[model samples]
Target chain A: MRNPLTEAFGIEYPIFAFSHCRDVVAAVTNAGGMGVLGALAFSPEELEQELTWIDEHVGGRPYGVDVVMPVKTLDRDAGIDDVSDIGAQLRSHISQDHWDYTDRILTEHGVDVAARDDGLEEGAGLGAGVLGWTAATGAPQIDIALSHDIALLASALGPPPKAAIDQAHEQGVKVAALIGRVEQAQRDVALGVDIIIAQGYEAGGHTGEVASMVLVPDVVDAVDVPVLAAGGIGGGRQMAAAMALGAAGVWTGSIWLTVAENGSSPVVTEKLLGATSTDTVRSRAYTGKPARQLRTAWTDAWEAPDSPGTLPMPLQFILNSYASQKMGATPPRELVGMPVGQIVSRMDQVRSTKQVVVDMVQEYVDVTERLTADLEG
Target chain B: MRNPLTEAFGIEYPIFAFSHCRDVVAAVTNAGGMGVLGALAFSPEELEQELTWIDEHVGGRPYGVDVVMPVKTLDRDAGIDDVSDIGAQLRSHISQDHWDYTDRILTEHGVDVAARDDGLEEGAGLGAGVLGWTAATGAPQIDIALSHDIALLASALGPPPKAAIDQAHEQGVKVAALIGRVEQAQRDVALGVDIIIAQGYEAGGHTGEVASMVLVPDVVDAVDVPVLAAGGIGGGRQMAAAMALGAAGVWTGSIWLTVAENGSSPVVTEKLLGATSTDTVRSRAYTGKPARQLRTAWTDAWEAPDSPGTLPMPLQFILNSYASQKMGATPPRELVGMPVGQIVSRMDQVRSTKQVVVDMVQEYVDVTERLTADLEG
Candidate 1:
C-alpha cells in the first residue's frame, strides 16, 4: 500500500474514493482511504455545509473535494452575471423540439411529465443541472473548498483554470485533473496540476474512449505527475491491476454509490447491485459529452432515431433537470439509473465504506502476493 | 511466467501472439511464446500452405491457429453447398445503394473505384470476405488445421460449433474462444471451450463492450478454464496488468502487426507506428460487427451522414472486398489502415518478433519485482 501517493497524502492505502454523498466521503476518510466529495450538484452554501460536516467527522484526517469546471460549456459566453440566474439562462437555450421529444418519451414510459415543480428544491436529489459546471458557479465552490481543510482539489472535466490551480497551490491544496487522453495529461501537467486522474471509457460520468488498462499506463508514460487510475476499478484485483499498469493509486467512483453509508435512492441502488458489466453504456444522453452510466429506458429514448439529439453541456443537463426530478419523485424502474462504471457488476453487497476499504486492501495483498510468488518460483 | 498456461502449452512465458502472417506466427513460436495465425482470410488450401510453412519454420515448437466461425452469419442458411461459391452467392445480396455509396466515397477520396478488377487473386492481401466466416468456409480450414500439429484451435468471433469442438478434442487439440462478455465466456465453457480469451473493447478487430481490466476478472470468476487476457495489451507492463487481473496469459494482436516479421503494407505500418491510443475507434465500418481499427478515411467515409449504413457481417466485408484490393494496390495512405488496438501508440519501433517477446518478458519480470518490493516493504 505504500507508494508516493500514500506517503504524500498521509493515507494508509492508495485508494481514492469519489462520491457525491458527504457521509460516504467522511466514512472513507475516517477509514484510512481518502474520500473526495463531488461538488457538481451542490450550491456554494450547500457545499459549505457538506465540507463543514466532513471536516468535523473525519477527526483531522485528510479528505478532498471534486468540482466540475467543464472547459467547454454552452453558457461560457452567455453573459449571465449572476450564478443563480445561469441555470434559468441555459434552460432558455433548450429547443422546443427537444422538449417535445423528452415529454413524449416520459409520456410513453407512463411517467407524469407535469409532476415536476418550477422550484430548485424539487431537483435536489436528481442533481442541479447547471450548478458548478461553469466558471461562474465553480469559482465559488473552489473558493469554499480552499477555505476548508481540504487536502486535494480535483476538476472532473478538462484542466482547471491556471488561476485556480495557482490559488489551490497557494492554499497548500494539491490540484488534480481527470483526463481520458494522453494529450490532456500533458496539458494538465503543463498547467501545474499536482496529480492526474486518468479516467477511462468504462468509468462513470464523463470518460474518454480509452479503457483503464491502457489509459492508466499511457497517462503515466506521458506525464510526470502521480497518475491515479480511474474507471472499471472496483475491488482489490482491479486495484492491483492499476498498480501493475504504473499507477500510483486507484480512483474509484461507482463502487461508493452502492455502499451502505451512501444515500442513493433504493431503486438506483438495486439496479446498480444487480447490473452486470454489460449493463452500462457510454452515451451522451445524460451529459453533453459521452459518459458511462447504467443503460436505462431514458437513455434509450435519447438514442432512438426519431428523438431529438442531446444539447451541449450546461444546456443538456438543464433540459434533463426536470425529467430527472420527476423520475426521482416517482422512479420508473426501467428509467431510474445513475452514473455507474463497468464495475457495477462487482458491487453486489451493501457493505460499509470501511468494510469495502478493508476488503479491497485484503484482496490487493492476496493478488500481489500471488503475483510475487509467480516471480519467485 | 510459470502459470498453468505456460506449463500446459510448454512455452517459456505466458504470451500468446495473434497474427495473420505465417512468418510472424512461426517467429513468435520460436521465441518461446505461442503464436496463433488468424485463419479468416485464407482458403483451406492457403491455410494448409501457411501451416506447412510454419511447421517447417518453428522446429516443431507449439503454435495455434485462429478461425472465424461466427455463430450467426448471413450465409448460415444460404444453402450454398460449395465453400468457393459462398463468396459470390453472398456478394449478390449487397444492395445497389451500398455499392454507389462505396464508390462515391472512394471517388471523393481521389481513388478510382472502377480500377478494381473482378478477379479473386486481386483480393489476396486484403482479407477475403465471406471466407471462413460461416461453417461452409470454416469447416474445411479447421480440417486442414487439425491435419497439422497445431497445439490449439481458437474461434475469433463465436464459440466454435459443438461438432468442431468434439472433433478438435478427439484430435487432442485444445479449443479456445474469444469473448467480450462474461455470459459468452460461460457459454463457451459449457460448449467445451478449453481456454477463454476475454477480448476487451480496446482490442483490435472484433471486440465487445467490456474492457479487459473488468472483463478478464469477470470471465475468470465465471469460468473454470484458464483465461488469456486480450485487447489493449502490447508491452510487458500490460502483460503484468493482465496477470494481476487473474488472466493466465496475454493474447496480443495489434502489437504483432507492427513487428518486423509481419507482412503489413508499408503505409499501414507507418500509420500504425505514428498512431496514438486515441487514433483508433471501435467502428462497424470494416466489419459489420463493432471492431477496433485505425481511424482512417475508409472508416470515416463509412460513418459519414450521407453514407449508406454498413451491412451485416459477411455482406459488409464482401462489399468492401473490391475497395480493399484497390486501396492495397494504390496504397491510399489515409485509407490503408488495418485492425489495431489502443496499444498502437506503444508500437513505436520496428523490432523483430523475437526481440518483442524478449522485451515483454523482461518488462513483465521488472514490473512484478517492483510490485513484490511494494508488498515486502
Candidate 2:
C-alpha cells in the first residue's frame, strides 16, 4: 500500500483510476485512491464544470485531469489558431468517400443515419467531432484544470506541450504522459513530465504494440521518473504484477467503465460485462490510430474489403461522430461499442467505485503477502 | 527460488528457456532451468539427433521438447494422411498469385529469385514449407519427443492432441500447451495437459491478442493446472511480475536468441542485439498466422499497400519459404529477420545460457526481497 507514488501523492494506495464520469472520479478519490477525470469528451467550459463538481464532492482530496494532446493530429499540421473554428476546420479534412462509406455502413446496420438530427442539434452530444484532442482545444482544458485544485495533469497521447508542462509545474501540478514505447518515456521525462504512464497494447484507448509485462520494466529502466503501469490492469493481482514490474502504480481505465458510478450507457455496460478478453480488438476504425475497443458491426464495416478505410486522427473521429450520433439515437445494439481494454473480460459485475478500489487494494495485499511467503518458505 | 513449477519439474529455477538450438537447450538445462527445444524446425530424425545431443550434454538434467500441433490447419481440412506427401499437397492449395507475389517481393528486394536453386535444392533447407504444424507433421515430432528422455512435452499452438497428451502421460512426460486466451487455457487444461503456457500478444511466433500481464492471471484463474507465463518475459523482474500475477513460472523465447549457445546466424543475432522492442512487430507475412518478428524490409514489404495480403496458416509459410530460401543463400541484412518478442530490447549482450539463468535468479531474489522489505517497513 505504501510506495513512492503513495508517499508522493499522499494517498492510501497507489491505484490511479481514469474515468470521464465526475461521480466515479469523486468516489475513487474519496475512497483514498487518485481519480483522474478524462477531459476528451468535454468542452473547456464543460471540463471546468466537471472539475468544479469533483472539487466540491471530493472535499479537497487530490484528483487529476487527463487530456488528449496528441503530437501528430491533423490540426497540428493544419495550423488552426482559433479553438472555436478547430472542429469545423478538422471536419473539412474528412473526405466525401469516407463520410458516404460510414453512412452506408450505418444504414445497412439499420441505423437511421438520415434521421440522426431528429431531436439532437448539430454538435450537441458526445459524438461531437474533434473534442479536445488537438493543442488548440486541449490547451484551454489544461488552463481550466490548473485553475482547479488538481494534483496531476495527464496527457493521453504524446508529451504534454512544453508550455503546458511548465504551466502545470508553475501551478505545482505534476504532469504525466501516457506512452506505450520506452523511447517515448525518455522523451516525456525530458520534457519535464513528472510521471510516465507506460500503457501497453491491451489498454483501452490509443496504445502501442508493447505489453505491460515488457513496457513497464522497459520504461522503468529508461526513465529517472516514476512510471505508472497502464493497460489491461483491472484488479489487485494485476496491480501487484505492475508493482512487481517496477511500476510506481497502476493506471486503470476500462475497469471503471462498468463500475456503479461509471454513468456509461446500460447497453455498453452490458456488452462490457458479457465480453471476454478476446471480444475486444485494437481497431483503427474509430480513432484512425489503433485504439482497443469492443469489436462491433461498426468496426467490422470499416475493416471490410469494399468499405473505404478510416480517415486519419481528428478526421476519423469527425467522420465517425455522425455514425455515433445516429447510433446513439436509434441504439443499434450491435453497432454500439466503446473503447475498452483486454481487461474488459474481468469487468463482469457492477460495484461501487469505492468497492472496486477496496477490492484491488485487498487483492494486491494478498498477492504481496503470498509472494513474501513464497520467498521465505 | 523454488515454486510449484520448480518443485514439479525438479529444476533449480522455474525459468523455461525455449530455443531451436539443442546446445542452448542443454546449456539452460545444465544451468538449473528447464530448456524446451522448439521441434517445429526439425524433422523427426533431426529432432532425434538434437534430443540425443541434449541427453548427452545435460547428463540427465530435466529438459523439455516443444512442438507445433495446431488444432486447426489446412491439412486438418484437406485430409492428407501421408506425411511425405503433406508438403506437396499443401503447396498445391496455395494460389499461383500468392506465389508470384512472394517471388516479386523477393525479386524487388535485390534477391536473386531465379538463382535460388543454384546452391540449395527445393525442400532441402529450413524454408521447407509446412514444417510440423499440422497434425500429420507434428504428431511424428511428438512421437519422436516421447521416445526421448524429455521431462516435458509442450505444444506451441493448440492443446497437444488428446492422443499426444495420453502418449506423453503414459511415458511420465508432462504435457504443456501455450495459449493466449483464457478460454484456450481452459481448453488446454481440459484436454489433460499438465501445464498451460499463457502466451500474450507480446510473444514471438504465433500469439493471441491478450498480453502476458492480462493473460497470465486470467489463465492462472481459469485452469486447475499450473500456468507458465510467456511472451515478453526476458529477465528476472519480468519473471517476478509473472509470479506476482499468479504464474508458477516464466516461459521465455526471445531472450535466448542472443545467448552464446543460441546458434542463430550472426546476422540475426546482431539484429536482435541492436533491435529495440518497437523494432519487432506481429505480422502474418512469414507465417500464415500472426507471429512477432523483427520489422525488416521483408516484413515491411508484406505490409506494403502494393503487396498482396498474406495467405492462411501453412499456405503462407509454404509461399514465403521460397523467399526465405533465396535470402538464405545470399543474406539480405535488411531483409533477414527472426521471430522475436518485445524483450529483444533487453538482449543487448551475448551472455552464456548459464549466466542468463544465474542473472535471472539473482534478480528474482533481489525483487522478492525488496517486495518483502516494502511490506515490512
Candidate 3:
C-alpha cells in the first residue's frame, strides 16, 4: 500500500488515470490515485473550463493536466505566421485522395460530411490539431494551465521542453514526460524531468516501439527517477508484473476510457469492450504518429493500396478531426474507432473508476502473493 | 555488409544455427554461422558420434552443441529412478475423466486407443518420458562435447551451472543463457555468463513471460555484456529492428527448422511453411515449460477442459515424449506439431542457411539506411 509514486505525488495510490472526461479524473483522485485530464482533445479555453469544473468537483484532491506537446512533428520548421498562412500551409499538405477516402468512408457510414466540414479553416471545432511541442506558440495554453492549481504538467509525445520543465517546477508543479525507449529515459533524466512515464507501444496515442513489460524496467534502469509503467496495463496482474520489472507505479489511459464516468461515446466503449487483444493495431491513420487504436474499417481503409498514406502529424490530425467530432456526436458503428490499447480486450464490462482502481490494487496483491508462493516453494 | 555479430563469433553471421540433425549442423557451420546441434534428444554416446560426424564434415568451422540443461527441473532432487517415480506420480494426477475425453477425441479422429496405449512411453519415439535437465548430471555428455572442440555452451532454461560456465571458460569457450526478462539478464550476468541470449516469449521452446520487442532492450540495458536478440527474428527487417533496439546480434531457431538443409520431415516443413504467426500458441502440453509450438489437435486435446492440466516440468514432458517422437518420425496431419515461434509465419520457403543469413544482413543494412534517412530528412 506504500506506493512511492503516490507519496511523490501526494496522493493515496500511484495510479494516474489519463482520461478526457473530467468526472473520471475527479472520481479517481477522490478515490485515491491522481486523476489526469487529457487536454489534447480540448481547446485552451475549453480546457480552462474543464479544469475549473474539476477544481469545483474534486473537492481539493490533487489532480494533473496532460498536454500533447511532442518534441518532434511533421514539418517541425513550419513557422506559425498569421492564422491564414498557417491554415493555408496545412490545407496544401492534405491530399485530394486522402480527403476523398475519408469522405467516402464517413458518407458510407451515414455521417454527414458536408455538415461536419462546414468549410472550416485550419484548427476548427472543439478540438483542433495543435502541435503540442512548439512552446512559443503553446506557451499561452501552458500559462492558462498553470493559472489553475494543476499538480502536474505532462507532455505525452516526448520530453517536455526545458522551459516547460522549468516553468512547471517554478510554479511548484511536477513535470512528467512520456518515453518509449531507454535512450529517451536517459534524455529525460538529463533534462531534469521529475517523472518518466514509460509508455509502451501497447498504449493508446503516440507510442514508441517498446512494450510495457520491457520498457518499464529499461526506463527504471536508465534513470534514477521513479518510473510509471504505461501501455497494455489494465489489471492488477499486469501492474504487479510492471512493479516486479521495476516501475514505481502504473500510469493507465485506455482502461479509464471504458469507465462509467468516461464520456467516450457508447459506440466507442462498446468497441473497446467487445474487442480482443488482436483487435488493436499501431498505425499512423489517426495523427500521423504510430498510435495503438482499435482496428476497424477506417484503419483497414487507410491500409488499403488505393489510399494515399496518412499525412504527417498535425495535418493528419486536422484531416481526421472533423470526422472524429461528427462520429463522437452521431456514434457511427463502422467509421468510428477510438484510440485504445490491447488492454481494451480485457475490458469486458464498464465499471466505476473507483472500482477499476480498487480491483487493480487487489489483483496486484493477489498476484504478488502467488508469485511469492512460487518463489518460496 | 559487415555483420559485427558474425565477426565476433568468427562465423558467417552471429547466427547460432540450432538443429536436432547432425548433417544440418555441419552444413550451417560450413556455410558460416556456427551450427549448434541439439543434443537433448541424443544420449551421451550418440551425441558424441553426432558431434564427431559434424566435426568431420565442417572442416574446422567453429560449431557448438546445445543441451537442455535446465537450471531447475521436476526431479532435480531425484536421480533417474526418481524421474520414473515422478512419471508415476503424473499418471496418478491425471483424472479418469480427462483420460476418457482424450480417448474419445483421439478415437473420433480415427486414432486407435490401442495405439494410444502402445508400448511406447508418452513422448516422441526418440525416448520414453521427457529429457530431464540431465546437464547437471550430464558431465559425460559435456565431456563428449568438449572432446569435439565446441566453442560455445548454451542452456535454454537458465544459466548453465557455475561449473559448466567455468569448464567452458577454461576451455576458451563462451557460456550463453536464454533470458525472458531484465531480472533474468542481471541474474545471468551475476552468474558470469559470457553471452546473454534474450529470448522473447515469441520464441519456440521454453520461454519466460515477456515478448521480444520489449524483452531485448531491457536485457541489453540490464546486462554489461553483449546481448543477442532471439524470438520472432526470421528476416532482415526484424533483425534490423532488434539491432536498432540495441541488440549486438540476432539468434534464430525456428527459421532454421525450415531451412533446406534441416532434416525436419517434409510434412513438418510443409506445415511450418503453411502456418502463420497466429497459428502458434504457448502451451505446456509438449514440455512442462511454456513453449510456443504449432497449434495442432494434439495440443488442443491436451488443453481441453476434460484434460488434466499439464504435469510439472519433466513429468509433463515424460507423458508426451513418446507421442512427440512418433510424430517427429512421421508427422501425422492431425497430431504433429513442431516447436516453433511466431516467426514461423515468415518461414514460407525453404532456403539455405547461408542464403537466409545473407538476406538478413542485407535487410539490416536497408532498414538502418531507411531509419537514418527518415531522421535526417
Docking class of 1: medium
Q: Which ranges of candidate 1 are over 4 A from the true structure?
A: A115-127, B77-81, B116-129
Between candidates 2 and 3, which one is better according to DockQ? 2
Residue B231 deviation, candidate 1, in Å? 0.6
| List of chain A TM-scores, every candidate | 0.95, 0.96, 0.92
Q: Which run of 10 residues does model 3 chain A get worst, by summed lDDT?
A: A368-377
Tens digits of per-residue lDDT for model 3, B203-228: 88777645664466556656888888
Q: What lDDT score is found at residue B111 in candidate 1?
A: 84
- Write down the lDDT that model 2 would get: 0.84
Deviation of model 1 at B322, angstroms:
1.2
Question: Which numbered prediction scores highest in TM-score against the true structure?
Answer: 1
The true-versus-predicted C-alpha distance at residue B48 of model 1, in Å, is: 1.1
Fnat of each prediction? 0.76, 0.69, 0.01
Off by over 4 Å in 2: A118-129, B118-129
If ranked by DockQ, best first, what sequence of candidates would result?
1, 2, 3
* Positional deviation of residue B7's Cα in model 2 after best superposition, in angstroms: 2.0
| Cα lDDT over the full model 1 | 0.86
The better candidate by TM-score, 1 or 2, is 1
